[model samples]
Target chain A: MGTTGTDIRYLVIIGIAVMLLLFTSFLLALIFNQRKKLKYQQSMEKLREQQQNQLIEAAVRSEETERHRIAETLHDEVGAILSSAKLHLLGIKSDILDERDQQLHEKGRELLNEVIQKVRGISHNLHSNILKEFGLNEAIRHFIRKIAQGTVLHATTALDDNYKTENPDNDISIYRMVQELVNNILKYANATEFIVSSTHRGNELDMVIFHNGDGLTQEQFEELRYQKEGLGLKNIQNRIILLKGSIHFTSGSEGYRINIHIPVKSNQP
Target chain B: MKLINFIRDWSEVWALLIPLIIILVFKPAKKQLRPVILYVFAGFILNFLATFMVEYYYLMPSWTYTDGYVNNNILYNLHSFVRVLFLGWYIISVRQYKFPFLLKTLLIFYLVFVITNFTFYESPFILSTRLYAAESITLLVICLFYFFRSMQDESDINWLKHPSFLIAAGISLYEVITFFIFLFFYPLHQKDISFAAVTMRIYTITFVVFCILLALALYKSRKKSNLSGVTG
Candidate 1:
């Protein structure tokens, strides 16, 4: 009886200890399992993000390619035809005609000249040859000069000359973003002044735009970027995401400002 | 000596009180945690009475005695009842399961079983091993379901730090460790008092760990307003 009692005692103790050990093992297994699940979920999210970025990159690239095609066609084909038509109109002798006929001939020449200028301007705006040759800084300057030509809005640029272009594709993206922002400002913002400034520090390029106009706050930008009408903003965001950069918008009582930060990879070595 | 005895007798009370105070002090999002708070409060009150009776039952009037022995098992029985009720309520409130009606029916059936077993077959004043076994089984099954569902969840939440996970873990730990002991508690006590005492001590230690986990869950919880408001 004594031996039996002692054996029972050992069995109970062993059972309890074993159960505890099992529970501990179970908890460890649970934690490890959860960690594995978490890693899997994170990898899945990253995969989705990469796929979405690829789609956006493809879309943006195709859009740029189409714009370049249309610009080349306009410049090389339509501009040449318009210039030839103007030359043919000019070849006629206006001095040998009556006063009214000469006046009509002069008007035709003036109209043809204006039509040629308009076509050329449209082609340049669509795809800037300056952007291809002189880089982003000169192209932006040319853009500002063109927009502020006869408009009430006084625009200025304080771009850093220290910037050395390494990626032309990134330059085109930056130029397009600037163009979209300025166009949005012209369409919606009833302001009289705008400033586009750039600073190159170390490996980062910072472009800050300040305007006395109604502009979106960061929250508003985030909210609007998911909307249908915000396609342009979405494209800008896609470009920023592709460049692995950030864009911040700030609005004050006096004016609004947007800061674009991009990490520029240098090839100076 | 008296103070030492008091501490020894009321050890589980102290363990239960820690989480109760933490939950009250932290004031976790009350909308989701109301059932948990209620369970803790109910458990604290029941445990305090049960411990108090164990310590001071000799001073009580004779009418309070059952079969000439001071039996505080009914308090523990009530504690078991509320433990299942409020814990089940907390689970039901949070998750959108397929069979809520079935869960509600099961809870009702559990109450009926407790009443029938205590009234007809076994006295509540004496520790009802059957009732405890049933409670432990029900809780274990519920916790298993909770775990299975949580494993399949795809949210970006850190389950290790989540309050629901911690509460489920605490309950599961307590249930898993002490289940067989409760199932054979009477037989073991009849055969060897010393062995039963040791097992009961293990139960006490497990309860302490459970309370600490509950405290951690409460600490990790945040107010609903804090959860909703976005910071710049």
Candidate 2:
């Protein structure tokens, strides 16, 4: 009986030890398998995000291409036609006409000149040739200058001279976001003073805009961004997301301020 | 020999304190964790009482004895019942299984079975091997069901860090480790008392590990809730 008891003790010990070893192995397996699954899920999420960004880039690029086409057609074809019409109208012998006819011709010439000037301004705004040639800094300063000239708003820019364009695509995205925000301010803020500033710090580019007008807070921007009427703001957000950047809106004592930060990726090779 | 006796006498009782202290100190106030809190608190109390009864059953009232022997088996029997009840409640409340009616029915049936089995066939003062087997099997089934249901869930939760997964894993490991020993405990004890003691020590070791796992689960749960509170 004593020998049998000793054998049984050994057997139970072995059994429990085996059971514990097996359970440990099983747990480790479960953890590793689940970790593998999580990795796969994360990669799939990254792939989906990459695909979405590609779609947004394609849409924005196509829109820019269409704008360039329209601007070129207007500037080259329509402007030439209008200029020729002006010269022909001017060449008409006004001296041979009655006084009333001469007045009508002069008025017609004035309207044609105004139309030509307006067309030129529209073409310049749409084409973005200055942005392509001069980069984001000059483009933004030029935009602010145009705003200051064309509206009652006193707009100013203090862009960083050290800021160099590493990627034109990213620059275009930044320019578009700034353009949209400025437009929003002009259309709604009703304030007179607006300022745009940029600073390049190491590998980060920070841009801030201040306007002394009624503007959006971060919460309001979040709320408005999901509404149907906020498509422009949503597009701006999507572009910022593609650029892997962030935009913050705040209302200070003076008025409103927007801060944008983008990580500068060096794609120069 | 003294070490073995000490371990055999107090391992499970002391192990319960680990998770109990964690729950008390951390105070995971989430509604989903309430059942776990109650389970650990109640388990600690019951286990402490059982350990005390084992050491001092001779000084207790006659009603606590059977056939002139100090018998603390009733406390173990009671723990099995509480174990199923609280753990089952945790599953029902947290998992919200699809066929909740079925699980509730099973709980009711198990409760009735425990009462009837103790009243008629088995003296609660003696180790109720039947109750241990029934409890282990039931809990094992519930733990397996939890894993299966978690498999079907589409949420991208880290299963390793998930409190529910940890609880299920702890429970399942304890159940599997002790199932056979508890199943044949009565026969083995009668055949060779020394062998039975050895098996009980092994059970004690597993119980200690199980309690540590429970403590970890509670800690993880608290951390997760705090994180969500900050981010939400």
Candidate 3:
């Protein structure tokens, strides 16, 4: 066995130490590269999701515009023509015609009045002028009053007096969603009682509907929403999505309940 | 001096125990890592045989000329050859590079060079410092390749938590630090016995640390397997 001097040993040790330091630095760089890659992937996923949501929003807005146009056409063009016809028939003097002919003219005017009312009702259902002029609360009240007159199904409502939306379009969408939900109940649920209530707290709005009827479980609701026969539920879902809101359905032996929450500020525009 | 003597005495036991533990603990869970585990287990057996032959030669010095060469040197050379073969297999198996033909050609060239040097130039009885240096540098390159390819992977895997990454890191760190040490082994042995002893101590310490990292890799692989089982 021979011996090398101390200087050479010291140099070797320093060299080994340097190599270890370099390896440590390389490991750090590898970790940084991985983290940067993960962050980039996450940001890309978020951008894709934002783009999809924007597309949905644009579609809902176009649909509302089309419905408004149709409602205006039915109300202004068709209803005005029917009303003028009724007016001219009423103006025909009873003294200028025999009894049977006068009776026939009066009957024709009555039928024209009925037709005019039917057209006006359809136009209102398509796009409610009441919702645009007076806001969501009055619109819902008027809707409930109309239903109560038409059906034996007892309907009740409790809406916040202070509930106000800066965007009338948002108000119309919310009103339409509630209308769809009630329509679903009328068509499907053989329930004796339907109850609706709403509240506004800070920038949030909560609406609940309850009924003693055959109800849907969460799975059933999801299944129905994607089916062809579930257009009303689908429409309600689309409007809620447009509002950036959430809806929950609860069902039990006693009844069915739906709870909805919307951030009013987030729904603006 | 006492610590150095202790490490020298028990280094073979440590080597054998580490790989044995890895096989027993992770073999059941690591189906994908079977080849690596097999290589390690084989290396451990080869190391044991080499150590036994060297110890027997020390006990009976006159019984070494059966094949016109020292049995200890033959055993050590065989051990080095087998170790390099397995290491090459590990690298090729885990490599993500596209040029498989080029990598295989380089590996074949390295094998030819090692055989020619051992057969013609370097005596089997002498330490093959040049071959060891070459092996260390090649392994370092392979480890670097693994890191680079992993960086390019699209899947968001936590490299720090990955078993293969941990093993590659350990190998890279050990190889880089020991490359010069291997190159200077014969020179240091000829010039200074004490310096050589110190260098051997450093190598043993690095080897032990490398073994610990390997054990951690096995443990992490086992944990990952169990998690996948639970989730699946």
Query: Taking chain A by itself, what TM-score does each prediction score?
Result: 0.88, 0.88, 0.80
Q: List the residue pairs that clash in candidate 3.
A: A2-B191, A2-B192, A2-B193, A3-B191, A3-B192, A4-B192
Model 3 ranges with Cα > 4 A deviation: A1-20, A31-50, A85-115, A189-192, A212-241, A250-253, A266-269, B1-143, B153-232
Clash count for each candidate, listed in order shown: 0, 0, 6
**Candidate 1 chain B superposition, TM-score:** 0.89
**What is the descending DockQ order?**
1, 2, 3
The digit string of per-residue lDDT tens for model 3 on B1-232 reads 9987656866855755775686686563656566567656776776666666655555546766556544655655665566556655666676557766766676687788888998899987666777777677666766777777777777767666777887788778778767768777766767667987888878777777776777777777664422110000
Q: lDDT of candidate 1?
A: 0.82
Which runs in model 1 stand beyond 4 Å of their true positions? A2-12, A28-40, A96-111, A160-162, A199-204, A265-269, B1-34, B48-72, B89-109, B148-163, B180-202, B215-232
lDDT of 2 by residue, B1-232 (tens): 9997886688778898888888778866567877778888888888888788768877788877777776777778888888888887787667757887877787888888888998889878777888988887788777766676665556787766778787888888888878778876766787789778777877888899888988888887664422110000
C-alpha RMSD (angstroms) for model 2: 5.1
DockQ scores of the candidates: 0.29, 0.27, 0.18
- DockQ of candidate 3 relative to the true structure: 0.18
Give the lDDT of residue B115 in candidate 3: 81
